[model samples]
Target chain A: MNVHEPERRLVTLSDVARAAGVGESTVSRVLRNQGSFSKRTQDRVAEAVARLGYVPNRLAGMLAGSGSTAGAKLVGIIIPSLTNIVFPDLLRGANAALDHDGFQSVIGVSDYDPEREEALIGALLSWRPAGLIVTGLEHTAGAVARLRASGIRIVEMIDTDGDGLDIVVGFSNRGVGCDSARHLLARGYRRIGYVGHDITRDLRAAKRLAGFRETLREAGHPLAETEIAPGPSSAAAGRAALGRLLARRPDLHAVYFSNDDMALGGYFHCLAEGVAVPGRLALFGFNALDIAAAMPQPLTTIRTPRLEIGAVAVERLAADGPAETVDLGYELIAGATA
Target chain B: MNVHEPERRLVTLSDVARAAGVGESTVSRVLRNQGSFSKRTQDRVAEAVARLGYVPNRLAGMLAGSGSTAGAKLVGIIIPSLTNIVFPDLLRGANAALDHDGFQSVIGVSDYDPEREEALIGALLSWRPAGLIVTGLEHTAGAVARLRASGIRIVEMIDTDGDGLDIVVGFSNRGVGCDSARHLLARGYRRIGYVGHDITRDLRAAKRLAGFRETLREAGHPLAETEIAPGPSSAAAGRAALGRLLARRPDLHAVYFSNDDMALGGYFHCLAEGVAVPGRLALFGFNALDIAAAMPQPLTTIRTPRLEIGAVAVERLAADGPAETVDLGYELIAGATA
Candidate 1:
């Protein structure tokens, strides 16, 4: 990447006006996308600007807008993983609300690293966004301090197990896990096992596992086996993890997965090995992704309020209402898989 | 969502400095992430700023920097969809490269709508980003014009069939389709079918289909059946489309999918129906996503350089390289399924 070269004469509005044969105000009106201009004029101005490589100084124009110091109408959203459909779905919902409000989201991906999250927080805070939305409550100490130090409205989304920095919206991960365990146990599945990806990175999954195990222990029917892949969860990893688990404990009646991605992997494994689903090895997962229901035998899982959490989070952020934690709950789906 | 209220009193640096019991220069140094300052002093300033709700005017600080007119170190990345792993993969790769360069990506999702792309272009350009990266060359005319007029470095990624508005980094979609057709034909499967989502929305898929047909015509073999889902492509849609195709023309020895997503759907359909993959029905797809390899019978598909396109596009943009198109071609994976 090349660094900025030595100073050169900057292109001004007058340069664009001279090039387009229009006044400075006409160039400003056309470039800002505010005032109306003739199609021919817009085209001519656009062509001239392109040819001259003229950049409009938005900072100057923004400050010049109607005698107000409103910082950019921007919001910052930081997510853990883009690979997971959950985050994308949340983003989709958030964008719907944000777009309607005429606010643009500036996004950052943490890739589930706390240090990266902190760095992104510092960078985003530097922009002084109107509001910031982040995935989970868990953050590095620096991130927490920086967020608290930044006066922008903050929304901690997707998890509610911990105290939020500001407005919190989402279901409890532990509750979803506890409900999943009870649902499976009520269906007469003892000798349960677990198949998932790394727990250290995915704190929400860890909470789920904790709740699942707690429920099992209370029922005097503890987990029989567990296969934890030391990486991010994928269908293949889930399938491989289940293979390892079943190879060791073939008598395992059922298995819980980190999420639908892992469960789908297990489901594929069952199909490949000719292990009759539910009758042979019942499968359960969280985040009832679309593929889960469309499976040959629909997957029995927990449907977390992913889209709603995002939409409502944006709504609250835009509202600038009194800060509060909102627990949008999850639902259990009884499908043919379990 | 509440509308912005009338203009109010603005918080100044002097206010922050006074509240922190420090000089304005000390506060500015800590806020700018520049000059040496003790942790205690930084904390004191950050606390005061948050308490006083002071927004540092980035525009003024930016202008205060050495006489370079570089806008905020931000790049705008606009994608087609977040639902498809393709875009997420692209984003992940782009973020990795951009983060390494100390640049941040502000993303917008178009969801394959040209109008949305145009609107997002206008909105993103309003930020006066240092550069902009968009998914494909086929954009609304206004979008193309605005992007050209914005005078920021532009990188058009993932497709290279059309004249780019700026630096283009991707292979030909038509070439990929033609190659996919040839791969299946060489494997001795002639009675081929096609399944996809809406062709009108995704111009790239339409280009692929056009190339596939051109190749098939050149081979003296045309598609036996075609199933194009009205909505976005998904595994379920793939299954339904294949089911429809088989119900009409059971003689289809092989099927070409729009991408791996639809192919995975077909793969799942074959699994559920007890049809032996590659024996009873052959499957081929584009974009060799990770799940395709994890399948019991790995899917035969074209591995597009999605990650490379994203990473290299950012590299080229950061380098401010001369305007030219870069073709980071595709690879054909001869997996077990085909």
Candidate 2:
């Protein structure tokens, strides 16, 4: 449980060059090897560097001594979670663009905690990153204030309908929900239930549910029953919730899950219970994850452009100023389940 | 894309103090506010920090004033993948232990690339972490040499059979596979087929397959067929693999999958085709993931103590240098499927 503290001496390249008895340019050249330098100079510089135990300051190189007044080419990205494949694909696309432009990207996982997100922002800001990308627009009061006054460009991702700080990049979750409701209604399914997990934490899911209910009300049909899980949505929890819902409302004709994970659980439940899918009950899900399409009756769900959202967020950050909002639309993959 | 380069020199703590006409330590204390300081000092420090942008260096603070001596408190973790739920559960357990002891953990993902693992090791070493918790014992030549020479501590996690890199904390994948075969044989299910992703990338899965086959041969029941996927295991790929395997071996009595994802896909495939599970073909999986248990008919699989592995790995790294090996056994969960 020992906290291994960091070394604090500001050992500059000048000190290494002085110790090596070489010019500053010679030391820089030997270290970076970007310019021509004699082998002897390289050896001497290496020896001095090893002796002094100097770690070169990449930030200093990017910021200091530039005639033009431009900040360092760095971007900070913060995501809710990395356990899911969605965020990784996002990182992959953003990494490709950042690497191409020689921009260093520092990432922090908030684990869907707003306080943690704020703390992470403080850490990321310490590097003075040129731009910042966050998972969603919902933020703590302190977090919002700091981000507002930080003067750096900001980009909120994954949900675009919220009031943005500067740049917004994502799709409309509400629209996806309305579309899901209409699809289910058109199929003559009147008695429908809703299964979700922690709707408050995932604001987008709440919006989707709102839209779904609105559409149902307009059509003279109401949701059969709403079941909410205690925590993060998992396939197991989804299955259990669906089982409970079915027990309570046996007459339900279809179910709209908050996302694909829960819907998959519902699908599995029906299979285990020997209930014919679409004949006894139809199923719908969101976030057309890979598993959804591979299901026995492919899950009818909405596919968010996760990778594209990440890539476009970076591209917008790289633009001259902050972008107001970029609505990268979603896709509704019609599968057999619904 | 024009990179949104900032147009200003980043203000430092020293600049802030100078602007406020105060000592650097006073500003630091006021910002951190760990100890008592006058209200005037705090106000002046805040004003100075606001006037001149200054961000604290967390890395520098953690290391400042600490000498070159290594501490035995840190448990560094390196996992190959995060997409699977197994690793996150492991991290949760490990973090609980480390957090209780006031220890901080730093982690990196290898993405199944040995070279990337080696590079990540180098980056992790810069922090001078006390002990290393690597994924598998199979490391590249350079990585092995560096780890051996690093002289801190090493604990290879999630596998125990092959070789030892200091302390090994996991069960034998081969043993699990062999046991699975015995379970199926006792039930009179023969003409078995195997479905798996790239076994070479995941050496553990390969070992399991080998053990399963060996057991089957010993029992005079050979594998009728196997469907090998080209890349990482996914539900889509698993579904496709199952379809191909069934098309090739329609008479197969049972099928064993690399993990729960593949098993789930196979289950979905059977559901879609109206293939009676157990009556026609039984399905078995590994890891006993949460979803597997929640499935309509719980997945018949081996349950490895993934979270306990993580907790024990951290404990070993903190308590002892390394052991020859530590065997954390596996379990067989007989669900309705098999």
Candidate 3:
């Protein structure tokens, strides 16, 4: 409830200093564990603040554009889904940094929808965040307009292939895709197909697919058949799509999926139908999610640096002036299935 | 920035009604769309609201008791984690209902920690939500005490097994677990084990495990070995946990997982390691998430009514008279895995 009855004026650093019989700088130093201060003075300041129930205003710099304030410190983060593990990891990292700095994060969920990204840019602008971090470079007309118009610092995350907004942080989806294709192809897999869901929504997946296709084309071979589900990729859709694809082309030797979720489904389909993985057909996926490697044979995939992107974004946002992009890169994980 | 500069008073619903030359009741009805009104009158009300930039305060009832004219309706939502899909589905449903009522949802992530729940409840109380929808009935002493003291309406969601706070809306996790056990038993699988991730933190998963064990014990057999990952359930952890379990006890014929994520992991493991599902080992999981059914050999799972639970909680809050518990119920899906 935003009950407008004026709250009692909070005890400020000045009040704490006066109560402690010390200078404001001395009180600040003791609280921040920075400059050397007498033990007695530190205890006095601590006691004064506790007695006054003084919660520090952390966002001083952000709100005033000067001095140190915890609440005003900016922390930027980008995630594929607010409702997914990838986002949670990002949150964990950003939260750690932001909370430490007395900064809070304003997040936007892309929903894997580029149009929504454009809309979110406007929503985030109201807060006048010190910095901005977004999922990828793929943006709708409205999103690009606001991102360009909004003067706040920016960090583009997850995929670092395209032109950045201001600060770019993440790995290359296309490179990960190419690596996956080469690994599977080297295993004597020629009749390779692809199964994915809503590559149109997930620009990163589309990039990976493009890279995979480029690698296949260079090898003088084209993808045998591709199956795509209508909406967000899920294990069930992956299984259903793969089942249909295999039903149409039963002799397919290998298949590279958009992500581990789809590849997991394809694996399940093989498990159910008595078609051995890597024996009759090889399977590969991206985002070496925990389950991918945990699988019996392990999923050969790429591990994106989700949490680091968040942590680094916040770190950069809290630094000096104007923004810049940073690419953290990704890792190639070789599991049993590939 | 919490600027202290003076500004004109915000336009209220009464002003819009006056400006539109309509009765106050008429404005309320039109805004809520609860009663029948002529198109001409509706258009007038809409025009006046737009012209004045009137933001409706859905806190009419609560504001009557408070002294200030500046209060926003608080819709408090406490979820275990945003990482899982189930909670997101619930959140989306709640958001749809709350948005229409001009109520903003303030969320607290408990991270499956009861202590965190206690802390979050304390923080949420400061906002003074008109209603609170918390996940599950189990809570720490401090949390329960604070909630009881708040006197606001409370809704315990995602399970209806234990004593509720004020209102409870969810299905029975125990029933879901038992039914899964029964389904596997009916499929003639004798040797069974349980695979899950951190049941200690997730009370609902623990309930499911309890029911599964109880049913198995009633059926004249006990679990072979329960394998649990030390973290949140995921396909990767499920795969790893299943692999380790299998290596320890290769003769097990079936395994019941805490939820779909873990089950998916186990399924992937089967594909990677050349384990035959159903033939060599059957897999069962809870929460028939989208991917569960899409797998090539669909997984046998208990489908939870997630969206319904969320929507019903909001509906109960909007009714706003007394509180009670609701058991929405769950569905058992028989897929090829079992």
Per TM-score, the best of the predicted structures is 1
Greater lDDT among 2 and 3 belongs to 2
DockQ-wise, the better of 1 and 2 is 1
True-vs-predicted CA distance for residue A112, candidate 1, Å:
1.2
Better of 1 and 2 by lDDT: 1
Q: What is the TM-score of chain A in candidate 2?
A: 0.85
Q: Give the TM-score of candidate 1.
A: 0.87
TM-score of chain B of 1: 0.86
DockQ category of candidate 2 = acceptable
- How well does candidate 1 match the true structure, expressed as C-alpha RMSD? 4.9
Q: Could you list the iRMS of every candidate?
A: 4.4, 5.3, 7.7
Docking level for model 3:
incorrect
lDDT tens digits by residue: candidate 1, B7-97: 4445779999999999999998898688899999999999998788676666555545524444457788999898888898898889889
B1-338: candidate 3 lDDT, tens digit per residue? 11222433446678998999999889988976877999999999999986875545323333342323224355678888866778877876786676566565656677898998887776555445667889999998868877765656788999988888788999888888788889988889988999999988999999999999999999987788889999888887888899899989999999999999899888878866778888999999888877677666778888888878888888887676566778899888888888
Model 1 Cα lDDT, one tens digit per residue, A1-338:
11234434456778989989998899888976768899988998999987876656655654555233344567889999888888988998899898888777878899899999988886776565678999888998878877765656799998889898889999899998899999999999999999988899999999999999999999999988889988999989998999999999999999999999899889888877999899999999889887777767889999988878989999999887877899999999998888
The chain A TM-scores for the candidates, taken one by one, are 0.84, 0.85, 0.83
Q: Which window of 10 residues has the lowest lDDT sum in candidate 1 chain A?
A: A1-10
Tens-digit lDDT string for candidate 2 (A1-338): 12222434445689999999999988988876777988888999999986775656544554453324353567888887655567766766676676556565666677788998887787777656778999887999878867765667888998876789888998888898889999999998999999999988777789999999989988999887999988888888788899999999999999999998888888888877877788999999998887788776788898888878988888888776645889999888889988
Model 2 spans with C-alpha error above 4 angstroms: A1-27, A30-75, A82-85, A92-107, A127-130, A318-321, B1-11, B15-54, B62-77, B88-108, B123-133, B149-155, B219-224, B311-326
User: Of 2 and 3, which scores higher on TM-score?
Assistant: 2
Q: Give the distance in Å from residue A231's predicted Cα in candidate 2 to where it truly belongs.
A: 1.9
